[model samples]
Target: MTDIEARFWSKVDKSGDCWLWTAATTYGYGRFAITKRQMIGAHRFAWETVNGPVPDGMVIDHLCRIRLCVNPAHMEVVTNGENVLRGEGLSALNARKTHCKNGHEFTPENTIVTKNPSGNGRACRECRRAAWTARATCPECGGSFSARNLARHRTNQHGGSHV
Candidate 1:
């Protein structure tokens, strides 16, 4: 075996289904030095060593969910977005929601997708309209107005004091 391969295998504990790396790690992922100034994920190295280069626009995902696992059998290549969706992060959790917090089903008609600096987010149209309606009722005059009209109503009718 080559020097690098031997060095890599020497650090792995293969007693179980997931081959765990027993070396340096960062953020729960095993790290390996491939060159004097370069490091790579140990799992990635293990995968490439056995299966070949990861496909373009694809990343390695650990099916075993163990970041330190270097077993190529426990990994799969997938798109970055697919990887995130399969994870347990906020984005994945939010994407898995079939209904809003107010028990409104996320039907196409009841859902409003909003684009922001972070990313696209889903909002319930009924909940949003309800919130707007609640704010649209003028407290001073007890008058009902549209959301846009409420500010003008408060200004013109209430002399801008309530606004």
Candidate 2:
């Protein structure tokens, strides 16, 4: 083993299925300082030590769901979306929700999905239309409509020509 690997292994408490990091940590996961000015997640450091560089746009997930685990055997590489889905935490629970919090069924017609800071999440299309209807006013026609309706309204009023 190399010197870096030795230092990393020294901090591991391998008495359990999940090899726990027994060193300084932030947010339950371990933190390793490579130099006076550099730091990286200990779990990540441990992974690269044995496997290799994690591919860009991919994240390493703790299959065991133990944030402190550094065992490469318990890790898997996946996209951010996949990682969130596989998690057993709050995000996973929310992602699995069949309806929005306000009881709107997340059908294809009523669900708006987009990337959020924490990967991807769905919004209620009905709520979006409602909000737009309540707040948006067309500048061209001084007409009241949701943004979606306003698009059609403009098209109908303007003889179906691009505005």
Candidate 3:
């Protein structure tokens, strides 16, 4: 084996089906140094060593879900979105929901596509409308007003002490 190959393999524990890297890790992924100052994911290194460079716009997904696994066979190349949707993260969990938390179906008409900090997301229109309507009522004076007029309503009707 070449020097880098030998160094890479030396840190792997091959006892299990998944070849676990037993060295330094970052965010659960094994870290390997290819050069004195450059470091890369050990799983990516293993996949590249076996199957060549990963294609642009594609990321390595651990099919085994073991971040420490460096076995190329346990990995797959997929888009970042695809990778996230395939896993059990919050985005994936939300994507799998056919209905909202309040039992409203996420139909084309009922679903509102929104931009969140993470990315695009779907919200139930009924729930959103209900929430907005709930906010439109003044709790102190029991008066109904538009959402834009909430502060004005409170200031004029309740002297701003109701907030």
Candidate 4:
């Protein structure tokens, strides 16, 4: 094993949770219970111990499914996307809820998609619902508009102002 890996493994206890050294920083700035900094350090140590420096764009995945585990045997190199999926951190798994705060259910019929500069998809169903509600209430003039003509109603009947 590389010297760094040997040093880390020698200090790990049986449970593989605690580290020999307290990590200076944790994942997501302490969002996760496991210290990711220590995990990275341990991974670096392991990689150097057995295979020399890790190549660029290589991410270490935990085969043990334990974020804090530093066992060299349990670490494997994988793409960042694969690592995120393996860790269950994909956006699809944590997308916004189907219903808004007002209990309005969002479906394709009621949803609007906005394009991000990076060409990513961002849905504004909640915003669309809020706009519809606002058009109904006419927050400024307190008048309702027909659902189909809310946009024109807001700009014309509501003093030519966009909501």
Candidate 5:
């Protein structure tokens, strides 16, 4: 192995946590501490030693199940979304709740599909109707449009127009 690789491997603790060389600088910052700096250094060392370089749009995950441990052997590269799903712990996995914020379960009878640039998604029609029933004035001009047409009346009648 090269000198840099050799130097990196020499800093691992018995627990597999990587450490930074006292002489090494991070992002031009100063020496590595045993705690915070060591964790960051370990991640960097693991990436550099095994992967050579970390490409953009990729994240290193701790497969060894230790966030502080930085053994290159324990690290794996994955997408950010996958990392989040993996890190969400057990609660998300066990969660069976799919209701809207207003307790509207996403059933075909109560859900409506709206087409947006992002694609079609389910919306609770009951919530929309309830929200519509609670409004009094046009949000744009303060002219009365009732709860039903408040949003549309604002855009079509009062939008970009004074009074």
Candidate 6:
């Protein structure tokens, strides 16, 4: 076995569903101190030691949801988005939500999509309409207007020549 593989096996307990890391940990996940400034995740290192590079934009996920699990059989390579959606956390809960805070169902016609750094989110059309109307305050008269009425309101109130 390679030196990394040897080091990895030495720290594993191997006594339960999760071949728990017996070495140091960070934030409840196994942490291996390779060098003074070369510390890395023990589970990730284990995956690399057995498999290869984790793949671009892909992360190693514990099938058993054990942060300390370094068992190669329990690891799967997946995208960050896929991992988040599969996890039992707040992000997963939000991803599974089919309705907006206002109780509007997220249908294809009524749902507005937004791309974010973490993932995409849907907004209800009714809530969006309300927001567009409520937020479109006139710079000239400070009056709110809906999307359909904003242009006419701006042109008529500002005399159409107000730059």
Ranking by lDDT: 1, 3, 2, 6, 5, 4
Q: What lDDT would candidate 5 get against the real structure? A: 0.62
| TM-score, every prediction | 0.87, 0.62, 0.81, 0.49, 0.44, 0.68
Query: For residues 14-64, what per-residue lDDT tens digits would candidate 1 score against the true structure?
Result: 999899999999999999998879899999999999999998999999998
The alpha-carbon lDDT assigned to residue 97 of candidate 6 equals 91
Best by lDDT: 1
| Winner of 3 and 4 under TM-score | 3
Candidate 2 residues 1-163, lDDT tens each? 8787788899999999999999999988899888768898999998998899999999999989999999999999899989977877788888789988789999999998889786777899998877776645666779787666777777788666544
Ranking by TM-score: 1, 3, 6, 2, 4, 5
Candidate 4 off by > 4 Å: 1-6, 15-25, 28-40, 90-114, 117-119, 122-148, 158-163
Task: Predict model 6's lDDT versus the native.
Answer: 0.85
Model 3, position 90: C-alpha lDDT score: 95
lDDT for 44 in candidate 1 is 93
lDDT of model number 1: 0.93
Tens-digit lDDT track of model 5 for 1-163: 8765566556555442443233445553222344443544557566776778877898877765555555666678888767755665553342334787788887878888787885445678899888767757665566765576665676677556433
Candidate 4 per-residue C-alpha lDDT over 1-163 given as tens digits, one digit per residue, 9 for 90 to 100: 5554455565555563433233333552111122335345554564456666777898777776655555567778888867765665445443445764566666787556566775444455776655666535566677777565666777787576575
Give one clash count per candidate, in the order shown. Answer: 0, 0, 0, 1, 0, 0
Residue ranges of candidate 6 with Cα displaced over 4 Å: 114-120, 127-163
Per-residue C-alpha lDDT of model 6 across residues 55-135, encoded as one tens digit per residue = 899998889999989988999999997998899988799879988998998888998888899677667898888866664
How would you encode candidate 3's per-residue C-alpha lDDT over 48-99 as one tens digit per residue?
Answer: 9999999999999999999999999999999998999999999899999999
